[model samples]
Target: MSALLLDTAPLRSSPEYRRLWIGLTLAGVGSQLGVTAVALQVYELTRSSFAVGLVGLVSFVPLVVLGLYGGALVDAHDRRRVIVLSSAALLVASVLIAGQAWLDVGSVVLLLGLVALQSAAFAVNSPARTAIIPMLVPVEQLPAANALGTLSMNLGVTVGPLVGGLLVGTVGFGPAYTIDVVTLLVALVTVLSLPPLPPLGGARKAGLASVLEGLRLLRGWRNVRMTFLLDICAMVLSQPRALFPAVGAVLIGGGATTAGVLASSVAVGSVLASLVSGPLGRVHRHGVAIAVSVAAWGAAIVAFGLVLLLASPSAAHTGSVTSTAVPWASWHLWAACTALAAAGAADAVSSVFRQTVLQSAAPDWARGRLQGVFIVVVAGGPRLGDLVAGADADALGEALAAVVGGVACVLAVVVLMAWQRGFLRYDARDPVP
Candidate 1:
């Protein structure tokens, strides 16, 4: 039982890591609150789902550009300083968002711009923070550390939406944004406490040449390259996350309440998976584990699609598309939520392995660059997936689109596995990055 539990060695081994984890967990929850509030606020501003989708479109470019450049910057300077400055940028972005809400600003364009700024800050912040983890913990404990990281992230994801919904419904968007600002301060203090983390020798000046060098390193690192490739496959193929709003209203017969539940259900599963991920730390074949977990994710998504398909067409197509609530009381709603939960759990498992593989395999000097690419794949793949899933959903019904996407996801894994024989046989005992 002890071995089957999450390893706490990283926290026990470093007080700085412990503080960083706690601070990040709280800050993450706060950030989620703002994200949910913004989505709701945007919908209120313009009753068009297309307008809401534009929010994602607005942020994607900055995130990709900054994510790559940020990785180079992380390697070129003190990671702690980079993180501190990025956190401050995020704080500023949050304050602007709150100010707009408090002022009752009526422009959706301004809101989109703020979100893009926030996303750019996040693009810089994530790689530096993730790269810092390897420096804090030993190689053998990378899996556990990664699991703990995922746990905090999912906790925030699960609670943030619920809290955001309540705050927006009761107090309004201003208070929700205010809460994020307060939480950001807490995270900022914790990051300030972290000791200076200068990069090892070979860090070049932060510029185009540096960014290209990182890309060059990424291209040659087989295992690191495989991790990014496989991750993109999982995210691009089966990520119908953008459709949750529609699923709740039409396919599931509930309104916004159902959509909220469906969205959070995935996080709930992720939290649960992390809690019991003790045995995962003992596993040796991380690559295989990632592949299997993603495959399971696809299978679970397929089940969710079936649930939507089996529902009556009347219920599947009726209801106001806006994220306003109708109570969710149907058993079918529960089934759909359950499937989403399963998919979320599988995704969490895959994420832990993928992160562990990258952190453990990459050299210290190159870790930041690889982690940057990892962040890009993590942030960008889903946006690309939204384009894929959204187009499919529009062409075919959402249910059939999901079915096809899930099947494509599984097939994608199989094809990648065949092409990369090295990844299929990768052993945690003898890692080869």
Candidate 2:
């Protein structure tokens, strides 16, 4: 096997990481189902794109606010216990949703509220989980550990939405929610099997102080700060999944099926890339690797938007960019799918390096807290991207918004590469502490 694949082996070899990976993947599947059901139910009831956005928005504050404190808590407390509590909360929330569904008393308001609760539970659980990885595997294997996490996320992201949409459409929301409950229960067993994680030695108490400490540490490192900023920019600007339903209906004309297909495409790319990512094990210049991958993502997205403009039929909706020459199959949907997939593949590469950088750089005591913040940023990014894409799609157009976002992603990465000399110049072999 290539070194990249072998590097990840250390992570795969760890029994505890393996168990957590499986559990989290299953839980993620359930969560996505609940999300799809809520969005479907909200749109069906209120018949408003705004309501769908609201479902995402409602989950935001809980995820952000709790994310920081929760990470700090992860640093100060037992990680295994935190995972248990988070899982338990998610389980209860899933049960509540299932009960309401079974009783046929579904309320959009109630569903949104429950989603917020589940997100908050996840807020606590996510950081502890991220923090625990270093403990489970040796230091050099951190990149592989991160790759494993990304792989699971890609699988869950792609499969979960499709399954969630299918289950809701076929058997009603009850079955959709119940599946999550069952999966979550199965995940709980994984958590139960984990050994206790004592707090890292010399970790500070959890509070605003800890939050500030995390912020300070993250900012002190020029690369980390820029990385976090770049993530925010790319996510808040160019994410296209939020606009998928509208695009499927108005642009591609396939409804939920198309949306599912489109949604899964990005994950498809990521999974495929990661599967062959054994090459990643050989690279040492992780910073340059991250910067270049992000730039590639920008180019891919821009190309996707170009697909829309180049197709004649899409040109009609997008105001005659292609002029009735190109075939229908060569239109907006195909382009979007292609670009999103490319972006996903590139992101997986960047993620492996970024995770490695942080794992190696972070102080032992503060690792959990910092990781918690990272998880929060990572999780909440898509929602922000959704809102941004949705708003822009209303004012400008979906095609235009995607194009702009892609350009922005490219520009941002280029700027970061130029500015963060230390990050770009840092040697992986010798390391920089």
Candidate 3:
């Protein structure tokens, strides 16, 4: 547990934190539903892997464009209001999606476009949302607060897609989106009731100047820069999620249902890991924990690929008839689950430190901006991986793509950790701010 959480565990006893957690949890579920809707809908309509991949492309561009500005806006405005406004925007997009499905008017371009708008709205929401955490909980309890938040989020995300896949597969798209809208409204109403969180370090009059100013601070802070860079490489190199469906159908031979099960398993692993992280909270060292955690993540991914290899070599040999398709069976599917679960759990441990480092290292005045950039890499890296790995899935094969990403991630983490002497030496006792 980070100092923020352990010292402040008594504070989480407050009603406000409970409400905030509940609200965010419901909204997290809704958001995951919306995400799953886009991917599954796109794939269903176009039946093209590339079109499915474009979902990330659509979401990423707007999110990247609005991200820094959103951070500045969060710094410049009320955190609660920003979250409410952004949640409302997301609701509108959800309503729009529901309407599209209701009318039987489905255009992949239009769907992607609306999903992009929702992404933009969400882009505005996160910085304020993250910045609000310190206000809701004491600084000392922030890590525990964060740990709880992670548990809720992982639960929502894991269950959302599994339910969503079943819903989209059975109940139809209209209901899936409608559920998201209801959840968002709940989140909005819950946030509206919280006590006011004053702007950190007084509001900077909002402008590009503030954004650049935030950037300047992060640049000068060596620990923040180094940890974030390692995060980027770690995420970019080994994100094999885009290939899950393909792997389910081709490599594992269970199809979409299997994909959902496999996909949900990753989040299950993350949730289980976090739930059991009593020891992860006690670590005193930042650099060693982060480096080792991420390297474990990379190695787990490689282990995942190797499992695929061991499952069925004949999986790659396709026949025109479905009967001739080689069956990799479900045990390999279980192995993939084990590997991904380990990866998610390790990554979660890594996340606690990374967030701690960023908050401790950056001046509170500029934490939102640094977090905004952090959000960008956090969100953006997956999309980048989708493009890279999705294309590779077409050209090479899903198993091979997983292997490729795994190798790159291991090398990147080792090199980055070796070079970032500053991050390794950072002490939490003396906060950079």
lDDT for predicted candidate 1 compared with the true structure: 0.80
* Candidate that beats the other on TM-score, 1 or 3, i.e. the better one: 1
lDDT of 1 by residue, 1-433 (tens): 7776777888899888898898889888998777667766765665444454566667777888999999989999999999999999999999999999999987898998999999999999989999999788777778888999999998887888767766765677789899999999899999999999999675568888878888888667787788888778778777766566566556665444455567678889999999899999778888889889888888888988888888654544445434444445667778888998998899899899889888877888877877788888987787666656766777787788778888888998899888888887888888788
Clash totals in order: 2, 2, 7
Q: Relative to the unseen true structure, what is the C-alpha lDDT of residue 237 in candidate 2, on a scale of 0 to 100?
A: 63
Stretches off by above 4 angstroms in model 1 are 46-49, 312-326
- Consecutive 10-residue window with the lowest summed lDDT within model 1: 315-324
lDDT of each: 0.80, 0.74, 0.73
Ranking by lDDT: 1, 2, 3
Candidate with the greatest lDDT versus the true structure: 1
lDDT minimum window of 10 residues, candidate 3: 317-326
Across 264-329, the per-residue lDDT of candidate 3 in tens digits comes to 776887788667665655666777787777888888888888888776635453311112232446
- Candidate 2 has a TM-score of 0.90
Candidate structures ordered by TM-score, highest first: 1, 3, 2
Residue pairs with backbone atoms closer than 3 Å in model 1 (clashes): 4-278, 5-278
Q: Which candidate number has the best TM-score? A: 1
